[model samples]
Target: MIRVLAFDVFGTVVDWRSSIIGELEQFGKSQGLQRDWGAFADSWRGGYVPAMNQVRRGELPWTRLDDLHRRILDELLREAGIQADEDDVDHLNRAWHRLAPWPDAVAGLHRLKERFTITTLSNGNVSLLTEMAKRAGLPWDCVLSAEIFGHYKPDPEAYLGCADIMDVAPDELMLVAAHPSDLRAARDAGLRTAYVDRPLEWGQPGRYRVPFEADEFDSIATDLLDLADKL
Candidate 1:
C-alpha cells in the first residue's frame, strides 16, 4: 500500500497555463500594453525545460525555479517588446505563486488526503510551491521542490529522493503525475506510479488525443479523485 502520494505540482495539481495567461492578460490591460498574452505565456514557458536541463546535465550552476523563471521572463518581455516597471516586473516574476488548481484538483486532493499523506515533489522552488499551495488551497501536508534537492524531475535522484525523505521503501511511495517522463523516472527509481490525465495542461484545448506514457504504471486515473477511489 502506498503511504505517501507525491505529486508534480505545475501541471498535475495546478493549471499553470491558464493561470499565467490570465495573469499576463490582466497585467497587459492594466499597463495599457497591447500584447498577445497567450503567446507571451507560451514564450516564457518555452525556457523552463531547457533551463532545468542545463542544471540536470551540470552545464550550469544549480538554480532555483523562481530564478529560472525570472531569467526567462526578462528575455520574454524584451522579445515581446513589452515593458514594465520594477515593481511590476517583480510581481510578474512571482506569477508562478498564483497558479490556480484545476476545478477538481482541490476536492480530489482532499479525498486522497483521507487515505494518504499528500505532498508536492515538484521542480517548483520551495517558497513558490508554498505560496501556490496557500493561494490555491492545494491541501498539501508539505511542499517539496527541486530547490530542496537541487535537482529536477526525470532525474532518478529527484524521484527516489521523495521516498528517502518520507522514510519509506520506494514501492510504498506512489508518484502521481500527468507527465509520463516524470512518472517513468519514479518507476525506474522503484516507486509505484499513477498517471492522472490533465488534458488541458498545455492549454492547446483538445489537442491531446491521449496522454498515456507507458503500460508500466500500476494505475491510471482521470483525476486525483479517480486515483483516490482506485486506492
Candidate 2:
C-alpha cells in the first residue's frame, strides 16, 4: 500500500511560468523596464537545471535554491541590461515563494491527504517550499526537498531518502510529478510512479507533452484530481 505520496512542486503542483511572468510584469512596470516578460521568465527558469546540476555533480558546494535563484537573477539582469536596486532584486528573487497553485492542486491534495501522507519531494529548498505551500494553500503534511539530502532529483539518495524519512519502503511511496524524469527516477528507486499531465507546463500547448505509455508509469492522470480519484 502507498503510505506517502510525494509531489514535485514547480510545474507539477503550481504554475511557475505564469507566476514568474506575473511577478516580472509587476516589477517591470515599477522599474519602467519594458521587455518580453515571458522570455525573461524562461531565461530565469532556464538556469534551474544547470544550477542544480552544479551541486549534483559536486562542481559547486551545497547551495540552496534561494541562492541559486539570486545568482541566476543577477546574471539575467546583467544580460538583459536591466538595472534595479538590491532590494528590488531580492524581492524579485522571492517570486518563487509567491507562485499560485494549479486550479486542481489544493483540492486534489486535500483529497489525497485524507488517504495518504502527502508531502513535497521537490528540488526546491525547504524554506522555498514552505513559503510556496503557505502562499498557495498547499496541504502538505510535511515539506521535503533535495536541500535536505544535499542532492537533487534523479539522484538515488534523494528518492530513497524520502522513503527513509517517511518510514516507508520505496514501494510504499508514490511519486507524483508532471516531469517524467522525476517519476522515472522514483520508479527506478523501487517506488510507485504517477505521471500527471500538465501539457502547458512550459506555457505552450505543443511546447510540452506528457506521454501516457502504459508500460512507463504505474498510472497517468490528467491532473492531480484525476490522480486522487485513481488512488
Candidate 3:
C-alpha cells in the first residue's frame, strides 16, 4: 500500500518553463536588451541535466541546484553578451523559487494529502524547494531533496533514501513525476510510480514528450486531480 506520495516539482507540480521565460523577459526589460527570451529560457533549462550530470559523474562535488542554475545563467548571460550586477543576477536566479503551480496542482495535492502523506522528492536543494513551496503555496507535508541524500534523481540512492527518511518501505512510497525517466528510476528502486501528463512542460505540445509503454507505470493521469481520483 502506498503511504507516501513523493512529487517531482519542476515540470510536474509547477510550470517551470513559462515561469522562467516570464522572469527572463522582465530581466531583459530591466537591462534594456532584446533577445529571444523563450529560447534563452529553453537554454537555461536545457543546461540542467548536463550540470547535474557533472556532479553525478563526479566531475564536480555535490552542488546545490540553485548554484547549478546560477552557473548556467552566468554562462548563458556571457554567451548572450548580457551583463548585470551580482544582486540582479542573484534575484533573477531565484525565479525558480517563484514558479507558479499548475492549475490543478494545488487542489490535487490537497486531495492527495488527505489520503497520503505528500512531500517533495526533487533534485532541488532544501532551501530552493522550501522557498518554492512557501511562495507557491505548495502545501507539502515536508520538503525533501536530492541534496539531503547527496544523490540526484535517476539514482537509486535518492529514491531509497526518500523512503528511508519517511520510514516507509520502498514499495509504499510512490513517485509522481511527469518524466518517464524519473518514474522508471523510482520503479527500478522498488517504488510505485505514477506518471502525470504535462505535455506543455516545454512550452509546446510534444516538444519534449517521451514515449512509454501503456502498462509501464502503476497509474497515469491527465493531471494531479485525475491522479487523486485514480489513486
Winner by lDDT: 3
Give the Cα error of residue 220 in candidate 1, in Å. 0.7
| lDDT assessment of candidate 2 | 0.92
Q: Per-residue alpha-carbon lDDT of model 1 for 75-166, expressed as tens digits?
A: 88887787889899889889999999988899999999988998899999899998898888889987888777777888888877788888
Q: Over the stretch 51-92, how does candidate 3's per-residue lDDT look in tens digits?
A: 999999999999999999999999999999989999999999
Candidate 3, lDDT over the whole model: 0.96
Candidate 2, residue 34: CA error in Å?
Answer: 0.6
Model 2, range 165-227, lDDT digits (tens) per residue? 999999999999998888888999999999888888789884856454678999889999999
Ranking by TM-score: 3, 2, 1
Please give each candidate's TM-score.
0.95, 0.98, 0.99
Model 2: colliding residue pairs: none
Local distance difference test, candidate 1: 0.87
